[model samples]
Target: MTRRSCPCGLPETYEACCGRFHSGAAAAPTAERLMRSRYCAFVKGDAAYLLRTWHPRTRPATLEPDPGTRWTGLEILDTRDGSAFHSTGTVEFRASYRGGSLHERSRFERVDGAWVYVDGDFLS
Candidate 1:
């Protein structure tokens, strides 16, 4: 498969964008970055990174990336401030895939100075 632009909405290539976080080269600096990396993880099937970055309180023991889907694009809708350093955040986005489309409003939390994805609500 030919590598394509990141579905996370970053201008950089996947390898240079969220790939850094997936490869353990860096930590996501903000809730938006964490959200982007998680999206990239889905695109690349980087389950380990997804598991690692997910907030333990809400994370599942395992994930099965849907093989039938081919993700085509992402559009971020909104982001807003949340709680304290250990706080809450939100990311609303739309993702298009071969099978269908998804609109989600994901919730996030900061724990131990790192932003971690907690959960999301499917809006579409």
Candidate 2:
């Protein structure tokens, strides 16, 4: 049997991995998990979930993903805190797309017991 892979490059199927977060069935437990899910959201163009998981302080009123951008892969480079025991952290990752790629150091923080993406620094 061939198992479907998640866009985040995880061995688990989308349903078993990032789908739960996309569907709002669960919340990401750590910075890396939240980062992976956000990458998956970009792949799926699930802007609603993306906004919902964004920190209210930084979330835009609307998100319009570029139609031409096709996300191809994600490589997590590093992480700090943002665990169950910590309230804030950062995730540095490289996400590839059709024409080019994006390297970002994303920030996250737990608000009201749920992880939310706060912001990111675009890296070259």
Candidate 3:
């Protein structure tokens, strides 16, 4: 059987990497893992997973992945305090698309023992 590499840029197959989290078989153990899975969700256009991982206070009523955007790659630039011992963290990343890239520092928080995206600051 053919194996699909994870869009999150991990060495493991999708099923072993972000897919595990996406399928509810396991939860991301750390903030960086959650960030990677969220990136994978965006690439796969999995709005349900995205919404499920979004902080309740910041989560929108609904979400729709942009079909027009073609995601190419992800680069994790920096991270702060997103560890198992920390309740909040920030991830700085650059997500590349077809024509351009998005640079942002995203904030995350542990909600009910699961990491959830809170918000982000766009960077120049």
Candidate 4:
């Protein structure tokens, strides 16, 4: 069987890279990992997983990914903190979608032993 590439752009298969997080078999150990997996979830249209990994404080009541949008690529620009020992961190990235694209600096924090997305600022 052919291995499906991870949406995170990792060399590993989706099942090995971000899929583990999506499947609840593992948790993202860093902010970048969380950000990548969240992007994978967006591509797969798994809003539940997105909400599940979101910081409760910032999590909205619901999430609805645009199914019409086709994700093209992910480019990580920078990172700060987000190590396993750190409780907080940030990741800046540009994600390409079909209709357009977005560049954002996203915040993350360790919540109950897992990295959870907090919020983000869109870049102009």
Candidate 5:
């Protein structure tokens, strides 16, 4: 059997990288991991996982992945705080798609002992 690589651009298989988080078998240990998993969720169109990991205050009532968009890659540009000991953190990343790329600095916070996405500022 061939090992399928994770959509988050990690060398590991999806199951070992982000799939575990999506399945609720594990929670992301850090902000970067959460960001990576969230990107993976986007690629897979896993809206439920995305909402579950989103901060309640910021989570939308519904989510729908753009059917025409095709995500291609992820690059982590920087990170601050979002560790096991920190309650909040930020991740600066660039996610590329078929026609363009998205650059953002995303915020994360620990809620009920789990890391949840808060919001982000899109960068130019």
Candidate 6:
């Protein structure tokens, strides 16, 4: 049987996929979830949710999802245990657009019983 791929790159279903994270299911069991939600937030243009889920220390006071960027999809490549419930995770994916594509490896951390996005490294 062909394996269904997660738009977020994880080998999971859409229902069990990033939707779980966006639906507020534990803000992702690891850093990967945070990264997915952050991506979903961008796709949906949910700046408020993005800001709310971002780590306070690193979270910008204001977030402006790039208007010119049109995110096509997501693909999570690999991940590791950052820590415990509070862990670190990495996601490598490509976001396509009218102009070009953006490849990024985003980082996330779990803090205060919640997952928050810390930062990301542009791979492209």
Whole-model lDDT per candidate: 0.83, 0.93, 0.94, 0.95, 0.97, 0.70
- C-alpha RMSD by candidate, in order: 2.8, 0.9, 1.0, 0.9, 0.7, 4.0
Candidate 5 lDDT by residue in tens digits, 23-115 = 999999999999999999999999999999999999999999997889999999999999999999999999999989999999999999999
Task: Estimate, for each residue in 23-87, the C-alpha lDDT of model 2 and write its tens digit.
Answer: 98998889899999999998998999899999999999999877678998999999999899999
Better of 2 and 3 by lDDT: 3
The C-alpha stretches of model 1 lying farther than 4 A from their native spots are 1-4, 82-86
Off by over 4 Å in 4: none
List, residue by residue over 1-124, the lDDT tens digit for candidate 4. 9777899888899999998999999999899999999999999999999999999999999999989989998999999999998999999999999878899999999999899999999998
Model 3, CA-based lDDT:
0.94
Please give the TM-score that candidate 1 achieves against the real structure.
Answer: 0.88
Best by lDDT: 5
Tens-digit lDDT track of model 6 for 21-70: 66666456667666776777687677887888888889898978888777
lDDT of 3 by residue, 1-124 (tens): 9786889998899999999999999999888899999999999999999999999999999999999999999999999999999999999999999999999999999999999999999999
Query: What is the per-residue lDDT of model 1 for residues 16-85, given as tens digits with 9 covering 90 to 100?
Result: 8888899999888777788888888888888899999899999998998986678887888898764345
Provide the lowest-lDDT 10-residue window in model 3. 2-11
Clashes within 3 Å, all models in order: 0, 0, 0, 0, 0, 3
Question: Of the candidates numbered 2 and 5, which has the greater TM-score value?
Answer: 5
- Those runs of model 2 whose alpha carbons end farther than 4 Å from true positions after fitting are none
Candidates in order, TM-scores: namely 0.88, 0.96, 0.96, 0.96, 0.98, 0.72
Q: In candidate 2, where is summed lDDT lowest over 10 consecutive residues?
A: 64-73
Residue pair clashes in candidate 3: none
Off by over 4 Å in 5: none
Off by over 4 Å in 6: 1-26, 82-86
**RMSD (Cα, Å) of model 2:** 0.9
lDDT of 5 at 61: 100
